[model samples]
Target: MTTHVYFDGGTKNGTTRIDPPFDGDLYFQAGLFDKEERYLRTDEIQVVDGVTYTVFRFTA
Candidate 1:
């Protein structure tokens, strides 16, 4: 089965969006830009619907 994860930045949203089917790990740092650009590691992203969204994993 596939799992879904969501990261909510709330008011502090980033300009970049990474979408699904990604492999590897993601590293993000908050408050690095004047706007809100999340500094993500190369593995933290995937492409979906022509757009990019961040991927998160659930721990059981």
Candidate 2:
């Protein structure tokens, strides 16, 4: 199964503090999900105080 994580950009430090706590290397399977769900990678994410956040693109 594939897991999707939502990030809150308004968090304190923004997207710069989510990897250290989860260890390094955020790996995923290519065919885990039938459709691609928007999510942020460890390197592309950050947390502030206790909030996490990320940036994403959406279709209109």
Q: In order, what is each prediction's RMSD in angstroms?
A: 8.8, 9.4
Clashes (backbone N, CA, C under 3 Å), per candidate, total 8, 6
The C-alpha lDDT values of all candidates are 0.40, 0.32
lDDT by residue (1-60, candidate 2, tens digit) is 112233333231122322323422333222344343233344343344656444322211
Worst 10 residues of 2 by lDDT: 9-18
lDDT of 1 by residue, 1-60 (tens): 112223434333333433454454543434655443343233355455555555442221
lDDT of 2 at 45: 37
Worst 10 residues of 1 by lDDT: 1-10
Best by lDDT: 1
Off by over 4 Å in 1: 1-43
Superposed by TM-score, candidate 2 places the C-alpha of residue 60 at a distance from the truth, in angstroms, of: 23
